[model samples]
Target chain A: MTKREPFFWITVSCGIIVLAFILLPLIEMLSAPSAVMLKETLKDKDVVRSIWLSMYTALAAACISFVFGTPLAYVLARTNFHGKRLVESIIDLPIVIPHPVVGIAILSVAGKNHWLGQIMSELGVRIMGSVTGIITVLTFVGIPFYINAAKDGFEGISPRLENVARSLGAPMFSTFFRITFPLAWRSMLVGLIMCCARAISEFGAVVIVAYHPMIAPVMIYERFESYGLKYSQPVAVWLVLVCLSLFLILRILALPKKNRNHD
Target chain B: MIELHNINVRLGQFRLKNIDLNIDSNDFFVLMGPTGAGKTVLLEAIAGLVPLEYGRITIAGRDVTGTAPEKRGVSIMYQDYALFPHLTISQNISFGVRYHAKAKSESGSRFERLVRELNIGHLLKRYPETLSGGELQRAALARALMVEPQVILLDEPLSALDPGFREEIRLLLKNLHESSGMTFFMVTHDFAETLSLATTAAVMNNGIIEQAGNVQEIFQKPCSTFVADFVGMKNILPAIFNKHTSRIGSLTVEMATIPVDTGGFIAIRPEDIVISTHKPASSMCNSFYGVVSAIIDQGFSYEVHVQVEDITFKSLITKGSLIDLGIREGLVVHLSFKATAIHCF
Candidate 1:
């Protein structure tokens, strides 16, 4: 593409500023943390436990997003009901609202004083300071990624394709599972990776809800406050490497195929 | 056989009200209409995609108003083909086959046989995203027919294909309908499809069937001025059949040497209205002495507009004749056509 005008220069400048402010810190972080220190810290009992909690909670949160959010995403993608934009705006709230605010909101709905939490408590379930609280907070913050991705996936499929399938002898629900979902599965996969990454790195809401069964993020923060940057660097390095590798893999997977079947 | 009785479908902006039509088994029915005439809606209604607001749709003598699309035993192909992009051509065709049978073994074996018969046996492994428009359509047909649907509905299936590929698909569709004996209902805005493939044609306007008949019958003998004009009738006027003679209707019928049957307003095709710059001899059919109102060249033919009394009609003539006659506006000419050429409804 040819350089257009001053607008092009302005866009480039803005891009430069964003990368410098956000990515430079990550670059510096990689250079400062040695592989030796990270390897050594991997053996730490608390470090290992926090890593385990992060993986499990992220997995649980991703599963929850898939189960509950997918149908809602599909509905939002396919239909044009009243207040659809409003519903979409509401789904996007978690991504924009401060993570701490997300914690407060989740607490009002599912905390000790909430009806949902009390009902679960009656069934011998606990939320505050428990693994459930950690996963719930992670899920709450990470849901937007899954919903948005799945919605785009479903939207990419023409409704006519589903119509043709239905006309050919597939029922309503069967058409979705057999045709619509599979075509958009690659998009859903990218969404899954994003949801998992978001869940693992979730700090504000998870910190507020259940800092006890410390996921890696909370552990990093505690170590930074109590023992300073040196103790937390190893965990941060490990998290970054894991997230980046998965992101690359998902990017490759999401690209649609290209080949011609000549008649 | 399929029939629609007073079928009413109300979509967002387009509505099909009081539509009634019938098609026999092994018929190639073409729904020809202008844009937004609810042709697609009517096709979808038959395929059981869009719900019927009122009236009933009967397929093969069975009431299918309440039945779901799959159970209705209809297969529809859209203009875009709507092949599952994630699945290969063979897989896409086999999809519906496998889908209906709970056992994988039964569907797989049937799909194999279908691909072979459709002559797309080689494309069973190529995904829809990778197929050309023609390939996708063949695969889509294979898939739809694999389940042995009672009727096939095509939604402008030729519109998306490149010009070179359209004829092949048309021939393929024709042969398939012939050999398979499947009732084929197709919607197309293109007039050529109606000419080439339609055994029966319906001209839809403002969500109503303005006219319908066998393709040749409708084209040669249009029922209304709408059908006449749409079917390339360029000279339609509100002229009375001449009552001065032993005539059928009004003054528009003219002093026929041989009396025509019933007539209200006569619509003569531009091509049928012969134009001669000089007074022609008596060997002609219906001759009208007129003055050339305007002469416009249309590259291939001259669009010669002639006026007689209050009536004005267009006559198409070759440019070679144009040079010979030196035809121009306001020049007197003779227009003639056979009485049998006049179609009255």
Candidate 2:
């Protein structure tokens, strides 16, 4: 072993404090629940349904963002026009707005008095106390993460590659599918995971939009409020475990290929 | 054949103004200029990669000003090669066949021929990042040629290679052009490349085409001071022409033909001025005695700078001649040249 410097020890001490701050509460909650208590919590039908709903709604939100945000991300990466900076700022607005404010903003546009809400009502679409409302809130909060990540990925690729493809008789659409997408798909996948992880943890916006559907975070809050710490601990532990696995996968995918361990 | 008329393009703060050019089929045309002279921009405009603010472009007698790059019947290769990293060399070379029906039918035989001729057959399964610079260039050339376009544009294809690879690729390009009879438009800053490969050439400076003509004519009789300096004419001086004689500094030199303008510049090639220790009884129209001020060793030859009154004349001589004449700085020497050797513009 090499001799350590004073600065190295100081940095390690700071890193340990940060890590403990994040991991201590989760470790305590995970260890507080008995094996029998965890088994019984998994057997509960309501717990199962809420956890499944959270995962399903979050996945749906990620898919919706992927379908809609890709073209916008590519355009933002490749071209420059009037108000481009303003448009980029607007894309990031969701991250800065308060969660309840996002919920209220969506409700204002979807209420019965508004023209858009009236059209949605006539078309038999409801944005309150429904699965649709849950997905809408999740996607509203998660798409910024997806667009920013995907935009960086697209920017990493050289436009000269596309120009060469065009000179070889491939049209713009063909070049996107054949050249740009293949080179950028890994970053897009990372973006999808980031969006999904963020959506899975949302509480304030989804609770305001659709409290009855009872996703995982809302169930944990309800259990803690009605039945105190004992009932909520199991659910929180489960949600934490799910998030841990998601971030583990993200870390693995984000690593460069040579740094990844094959075994 | 390719023709560009009034080609005007504005990109950010740079602009190309009122440019016109005509390139015959089966011709190797090279564009030479200093850095930031819009040589690459002109190549991109010809390939339809950059939009023109106001211009008309025609290729093979058809107007393609509004056409897309894919429909322009031209292929361009960049200096970096720009090979698709995710694809194998085989896949990269055959990428264009899927979009053109005629190429699709003949792609197999053509692919084989290109790989064999370029000596890249063993690299078919490799990726671009693994290949050397010369191999990547050959792969890019094969990719551009796979479509059988009427014209091809190359942007400094051999610039990034070592000298041995550069010579190899240069010969390959010459042979390919000779056999295919396809028009080639290339951009380079190397005068040697132009001398060896260019049938016709043009010089650009600050987005304007300074001169365009046969390569030898442009070298021997450049139309402007910029062209003369760019082509390595070592001695260029401001002169006042009166009738058949022009006065350069304190010396008056005879001219074979007078220029249309009365007052302009005159240029002389360094090789045209001969340095002698003694005055010769030759029929040369101009002769001067000057002290040698500097002797610069230029590898294969030496440049002897002689000062004649206020004017300094440069003469290129071999090392053998340098040693035979015992030439050194501060030694007075005789400089003489024929009247026809002086070019006035």
Candidate 3:
């Protein structure tokens, strides 16, 4: 009791500081607008269109991450192959680099200067300044988070389960789908949601690469720059409201309730 | 029929080499070994989970070396039971049954029958997390058996259970073996587990079978010093082999010894030691003058540690017998054993 004099006060102060840092902006934005202002913001054609595009592209980027990143994550989690360390580091490269750098690199690669863009273009596909370009940036920025989360999920699963599945008439792929995937799916779903959210929130790379097909974050930024606080606040509030709802739902769905409660 | 011929697989830091085994169509075989002795690897190899670098695996007379495990008609139930927590008991059982040629109705009926048989009919809709360890074990067995696999592999099926409930599971395993007549190849390091259900015993060490024989013969005769030690033989003294009996050492080291050597080695279990302070006139042949170094109270019996020169041999005596003998530390005692308990590798 002698030492308890100010410890509880310090804890409350820390909590207040964190809440001010994280929740204050959201509260201000939400409280700034009336119901009419919210409805009017939702009524904006460009805002609605960008929100739809953002949702679809974010989903596409998440799907892309799932396809390519899961197996890579599994390999990282399960096997020790040559060049694995280098591959893992490269997967995390987009996370640390500046978003504008990511944007520049994507534009440089898919802007007639690289073979991949040329190949896609040759196959009657266009990437630069298109919806595909937006998805490309979203996936490039968002995948490392997905891969890292999925890898940790897979890593937490005991290898014995996969081995058991394999021995129980499952091939390598069936073992993955039946045992490994289901066991790691909750965490993978969390990863996917976070990836989708991160991709949706992306502005810099999308702005550089595919600003014409404006996503929500870029639109928000554009409104702020062109017409200042009043024009942007309503759109920002609408977008944040939707994004926050989706994020909360996904987070609830992704929790391993049985595991947490049992422990 | 399941067989392995010259199977070879190299894992990091461990290698299984030139392994050969044959199990009858419906025999329950136990594979006993120390940890990292490649028991699970061998089971996985037979089940075709992991590819073999070199070997031929024939299951039920079909060459399944490159066959997928699903196509091979085999199932493995692991120590944790590996029951899918996402599915109910019945669904878990029926997940793989469709791969079999049985009609859907018949498969469903079969799953129902297995559920009832395993005493888990009430748990058909329950998630795996809700069930007890024994219940999960039953469900896992039901799932593996529902497919009517040609062979079932059990990897340390009881190692995860509470020790108090192990015997109950062991009896359940025994019942499964007897009632269904399914071929079960269980991998366990616990040798004292009931081999009554196992038609044959295959003891693995490092990466190879040290011995494979009838349970009694394996207990009675081991092929190597490792097998002898692993099979719970406590006193395996060096002996000079002369046919079926070997003297503990030449007459100089030990006195009045007999050998049960097969090729050139002998082993004696601790339970076979006969002790007396008054020097009983038994014709068991082997006798030694040693000082009692320690007395260990095992749950079932007392392990009397006796040191004869540099060699320390542990002899097990019952608690009642411990009372009669007044066994204590630092007492000079006369120890003796029977020739039948002495085995040669």
| Candidate with best lDDT | 2
**Residue lDDT tens for model 1, A161-224:** 8998887777889898888887889989888889998888789988888879888899999999
The per-candidate count of clashes, in order, stands at 14, 0, 4
Pairs with steric clashes in candidate 2? none
Model 3: runs farther than 4 Å from truth?
A1-11, A33-43, A74-78, A117-125, A156-184, A255-263, B103-105, B241-265, B309-311
lDDT of 3 at B276: 75
TM-scores for every candidate against the unseen true structure = 0.88, 0.95, 0.89
Alpha-carbon local distance difference test for all models = 0.82, 0.93, 0.82
TM-scores computed on chain B for all candidates: 0.86, 0.98, 0.92
Best candidate per DockQ, number?
Answer: 2
Interface RMSD, all models, one decimal each?
2.9, 3.8, 3.9
Instruction: Give the range where candidate 3 chain B is weakest over 10 consecutive residues by summed lDDT.
Output: B250-259
Per residue, candidate 2 scores C-alpha lDDT tens digits across A5-73 of 999999999999999999898789899999999999999999989998999999999999999999999
Candidate 3 per-residue C-alpha lDDT over B83-123 given as tens digits, one digit per residue, 9 for 90 to 100: 87777777788777555666355876776678777789888
Model 3 per-residue lDDT at A7: 80
Report the Cα lDDT for candidate 2. Answer: 0.93
> Which residue runs does candidate 1 get wrong by more than 4 Å?
A1-14, A257-263, B99-125, B129-131, B162-164, B241-264, B283-286, B289-302, B307-311, B328-330
Q: CAPRI verdict on model 1?
A: medium
Candidate closer to the true structure by DockQ (higher is better), 1 or 2: 2
lDDT per residue (tens digit) for residues B1-345 in model 1:
898999998887778989999998889999998878889889989888887889998999999898888888899888888888777776677667655554245776767766766678767776666667888888888877877778999889898999988988899888888888899999988877889999998999899999887998888878788888888878766543444332322223444333254345466778877777666665654676888888887879888888887677788889988889888888888888767667655
